[model samples]
Each structure stands twice: as structure tokens, then as C-alpha cells.
Target: MSEGKKMTSSRRLQLKSLMLQIATKRLEEEKKEVAAAKEAYIIENCPPPDLSGDMAALTEFCKKLHIAIDKIDEGRYDIEAKVQKINKEVRDKQQANCFKL
Candidate 1:
């Protein structure tokens, strides 16, 4: 069964855009919540700044943080490489078109 009233192309586009915006906002909220929870967990389990006495705990956290940061750095490099490849492909396509004219 179909509705008596059909939606126009513009209306469909508007609905899709609105849906995307709603999804993006929800994702942002979830990311913020996850970050807050992680921070809280770290504060509760990790030692305080006065680790001047228990250097062991400080050292462990440093090692853990270094590993996490290394992963982020690797991801950053991967994204940069992907972006450069995409741009090069686009430029190559454009140049190919120029040769035809």
C-alpha cells in the first residue's frame, strides 16, 4: 500500500539531511560520555601527582600511555597517507581530462 501523497525529491533530501544531523549529534554525545567515563576510571585507579614516592605506579602509567599514544600516531599516519593518495588520484583524473581537450 502506498500513501496518497508522494514526497518530493527536495523533501526527501531534506529528511535525509536532518537524519544525518541527528545521528551526528547523538554520536558526539556518546563519544563525550565514553571519554568522561574513561577519565573517571583513570582517576580512581591511577596514582596521584604525589607519585614522587611511588615511582613504580607512575612508570607503569607512563608505559601504558605511551602505547596508547603510539597507536594514535600510527592511525594519524595511515589517514594522512590515505588522504594523499586520494588527492593524487583526483589530480591525475583531472589531468587526464585536460589531455583530451
Candidate 2:
């Protein structure tokens, strides 16, 4: 392999690695933001039912809270899957480039 070609390949790998690192950091920040938002939403909207001797009302509130929690979990899973997909694509691209050299 020529010297120039080797340098170019090395630079490309460095750039790819930097990009992957930045993307990973961004994904982590996004996940943290989502978690914060979910926590805030739960705090603001899912207050405990008043224990004023109303069994039916308390049960209904509990049911609603369960549903909300389930939805939040599903949304978080979906977001995580998307982040993983992006990470996988970056990894695949890096592998392909490595094989090219």
C-alpha cells in the first residue's frame, strides 16, 4: 500500500471514530432528557389518589397509573431501539470501511 493511501485511510478511520463518539454522546443526552421529561410528567400528572374512603376511586386511579407507566415503558423501549439502530449502522459502516483497507 502507498504511503498516501495509508494516511488517507487512517484519517478516514479517525473521522469515523470521532463521529461515532459524538453520536453516542448525543444519544445518551437524549435518553437522559427523555427520562427527565417522563419523570416530570409522572410527578405532575400521577398524583396519589386521596384516601378519603372511596375504594372505587382509588382503584380507578391505580389502574390509570398502571396504564401510564406501561405506556412510558413502551415509549422508552422504542426510543432505545432507535438509538441502537443508529449505533449499529455506524458500527457496520466502520466495519465495512475497515474491510476495504
Cα lDDT for residue 44, model 2?
100
Model 1: per-residue Cα lDDT over 1-101, one tens digit each: 98699899999999999999999999999999999999999999975655554778889878878998999999999999999999999999999999999
The digit string of per-residue lDDT tens for model 2 on 46-101 reads: 78657785888888878988998999999999999999999999999999999999
Whole-model lDDT per candidate:
0.92, 0.92
* Clashes per candidate, residues 3 or more apart or on different chains: 0, 0
TM-scores for all candidates? 0.49, 0.51
Report how far residue 39 has shifted in candidate 2, in Å. Answer: 11
Q: Show pairs that collide, candidate 2.
A: none
Which is the leading candidate under TM-score?
Answer: 2
